[model samples]
Target: MKIYKILNNNAVVVKEHDEEKIVMGSGIAFQKKKNDIINRQKVEKIFVMNEGNEKFQELLKTLPEEHIQIAEDIITYAEGYLQVPLSNHIHISLTDHLSFAIERHQQGFQINNKLLTEIKALYKKEFEIGKWAVQYVAEKLKVQLPVDEAGHIALHIHTAKLGSGDIASTLQQTTIISEMIEIIHQELGMDLDEESISYQRLLTHLRFALTRIESNEPFQVMDPDMLEIIQTKYAKAYTIAVKVADYLEKEYDIQLPSSEMGYISLHIQRLIT
Candidate 1:
């Protein structure tokens, strides 16, 4: 492969079989110019540049080569740990996030991930990878990042695992769930134990509820008789569920089905009683 563009001393864009590819290695592009043939022996990794990836191309040009390498290494670890192929956009999104995170840390800034507890409770596997990544970065860059940063990284890993490349949606879902949990606490007037089975069940229900709404997948429709029975028997829980439904509709423009509310009310009743 011949060099089409040099991103840095260790990375370059090469042309192979009429396709652009990113090639990276130590000193791979040293003293090399455009059109120079890459030393095949020195090549370590070859990435087929995705078409219409202008953002990734620009990221390669501007981000420090070491940061990109760290991002790639962390991604490789995450994939191996999960035993799944992540979305290609994780290359762009994770690298961008990692870069910004490191820069902020160096400038003595801290970002608190408010969803840390929810993330750790919900995304255990991804959060484990995030903890490892924080230790890895601390060793590599000598920067001790806060555990909150691990939660942020876990969200990135989870977003990649989902193959959606939509971090905003993932964060929004986590945020909505957290808020809904708070609503339950305030409505029921109790400090719900996070480690309890009831709390876990509630989290699972809310997670699936959000997933159902987002995908527009229908759940088992409740009959009017059962719905009425639940509404009458668990009046407070049903009312809280209705408030949650209204909040979702008003804040996120997501209209939860009546059947879904019925299910949510059952879960809330279990939690409260």
Candidate 2:
């Protein structure tokens, strides 16, 4: 592996002779400008780097059609998800996931079922995201994940975690729920009962959960046993409000907003719990 360009001290760009692919790595620094000598110790991971430049074009030649296409899909999908435009930061996570998807496909790994019904229910938009990713991979690596295949993979990524890993650690219960509950209690004053306030907060939390679940973000319910009890106790409101998240997931395909999900889930908690 030869040093090509250093992104920063934490990252570097290099070319690998054996694989003949352009790669990027972390914990590396460039000694010179664009064209400079790179120290071997600085190299982290030697593979292809994404940039809409000559380097990207050169790197493409070394990749198979499938890989190239998958890479492209990863790029487009990432841009939308991250809300980041294409630049020197080709998004390490996105590229890594694409490579994983492509390799798994090549090696004949089965696609795991994660959010199948949810994604298929919101088929149009989800498929649009999937199509963009599939086309990008096809064009870049000349490989394509079937619509359903890509759908499963994409949903898997969204639902996973907050970080780069496959299992995303959803942020836990925040004081916000309790605080909001207090606020509502105070706002309702002597006119409303304490139980009513609790119910409101429970619904709120469920609404919040809806958003998180839809976005593949991590969310926490108040308590499981308590929630189930409420579901049995307050069957009517519980059933109606419970449908809020289901309706959104099935109808719009997009998750409810955080605030909305919180309110909804909170209400559900008050009822069943």
Clash statistics: count for each candidate: 0, 55
Q: What is the lDDT of candidate 2?
A: 0.47
Candidate 1 all-Cα RMSD? 2.2
Candidate 1 ranges beyond 4 A from true positions: 162-165, 223-225
Worst 10 contiguous positions by lDDT, candidate 1:
48-57
lDDT by residue for model 1 (203-248), tens: 8889988887788788879999999999999999999999998988
lDDT, model 1, position 245: 86
C-alpha lDDT score of every prediction, in listed order: 0.87, 0.47
- Model 1 CA lDDT for position 185: 85
